[model samples]
Target: MKRGVRESIAVSAVLLAALFILPLLVIVPFRSELLTREPPMDETEGEPFVSGDLDSRTVLKVKNGDTVEEMDLGTYLVGVVRAEMPASFAEEALRAQAVAARTYTIYKLQTGGNHGSEADICTDSTCCQAYISEERARANWRKNANDYEKKVENAVTATDGETILYGGVPILAVFHSSSAGLTRAAGQVWLNDLPYLQAVDSPEEGDTIPNYYSRAEFTAAEFKEKMLAAFPEADFSGPVDRWLKNAVTDSAGSVETVEVGGVTVKGTQVRAALALRSACFEWEVQGEKLVFYVTGYGHGVGLSQYGANQMAADGADYKEILTHYYTGVTVEPYSFALPG
Candidate 1:
């Protein structure tokens, strides 16, 4: 059977959305196809294709509609999938559609403007990459986007009610997507009352942290000396040498909670502050400066899409891809389909 694709226009900026994946609690069974083989594409259906030339819509300037709308790049991406992708990607698309359907369903039932319009979708920094040349996105489009549309369309059509209850309240529906560009390693999904439902570069991609692009290099000694320089009167131990030997440790107890300028903070945060203070004395070679350069983007707790793509490219099936990061979760039919 063929499935349909669904999409929503995003109004928010993409960079603003650091983390879009919502955490799990809903018992929706992940279809094996969601993490397995994608459904077959229907060559017969006449779907629109993006040629190497310019897309007409891209040139359309933003104008004020009857009601202003705002959305994240994630929502726009989902819309692109629905408008351009195929059923193969649609029926089994992961992450994006799940969030989008939930968001759309929520919004359909809610009134007022608790959520912004689709004008706010941003596509800057790590939040989103420039649209790939048609040549590059084609392969990707074939493998992933097409099928995702089907899945979203199905979910949207299948909703028994117009709105979904998230965190106990009904809100508008809008999905989000991204490389998770830059942020601390905690996955939160409040844009629509969801958490890391679609995290890419999750922890299962092995021990290597997905560096935004290197490593944290500030020496503990250098960090401490800078801290001492910042707070000369505070009773800090001996020179940088002594502090390096016993200051910071992975152990929770090693963290000393202290009040600084009327604000109490954890040892790690304090250590981080010292590192930043020291960094000010260093050089800004490429982009961000850090004592320790962490790799990848987003929290390392769920699935890593980049890793999954690499795996997929290397011939790893979707199930293998899903299992590699999602820990232990079953992928079965939810018996739900989008209503016509």
Candidate 2:
């Protein structure tokens, strides 16, 4: 070959060699980092990705009557946040409620709900979470309808498709109105000993909530009748002082067990029989009436709404509030697509 041609061929071979070796030199040392590197997450948005095609509809059976309705998940969540949590709550608190309600609804959908016949969930706060129609919610809001509705909708929108998860599964996401000063363990209130439902400090449940403290008064006859109805075998023939004895309570001052009329009974039984506000209570017999002073307003099993509001006021966002309430959990986007 001519000298010029030979030189050109040598240059071409060198270029080919460089092309073959360059990628290996750059990629081998950083292979692990590249493979393990997660996509850049939007700090403001939190989750890495949110599925747009996830099923966002649910069937709700309203307990007022036999009315059954289906609505978009976001819309249902707005109503739930309005009905379940006070509209006066901070925006971040409302957003936390929205995520919790969404997680609960999704959990019901995944696991068969209590209402087995026709609905995935119910509007009865006793059975499920309290829910109301948008019209009803607006009506209840009355003068504050427009602003409150906008606030609730904004909360739902801000945390759209977010849920609390443990071991990659949606959590039960139970919540209540308020707490005495701390939340209760799931096992303390119910049968299940859920790791994520453990007790946590909730110091923000101050006296601001209207129902934070309540009292129920019952005459001796009335109390006897109710208790006897629940525990028919109990002997109520003794004095009222001896009627209740050996009261055992939890760390949060919630009644756990008590001896009533020589029969052992759970505090839950007494609370249910008397229609008391919460299991955390103290009772005293005053002359002709037995009065129960209840410190909290609900079962005290999970997140406290008043506490969440206080945390939000203290500058914690929705995710932080949820993780604080639900121990060993993460707030993440719904990972699965709903059935068509």
> lDDT of all predictions, in order shown?
0.34, 0.81
lDDT of 2 by residue, 137-224 (tens): 7678877776787787778877767889999899999998888788889887788789999899886655777877899999989999
Residue 56's lDDT in candidate 1: 16
Which predicted model would earn the best lDDT? 2
- Writing each residue's lDDT as its tens digit, candidate 1 over 264-337 gives 44444544555421111112223222244333433322344444444554666544544444333333222222
Worst 10 residues of 1 by lDDT: 52-61
Residue 9, candidate 2: Cα error in Å is: 99
The residue pairs found clashing in candidate 2 are none
Candidate 2: Cα lDDT at 198 = 89
The backbone clash count of each candidate, in order, is 71, 0
C-alpha lDDT of residue 334 in model 1: 23
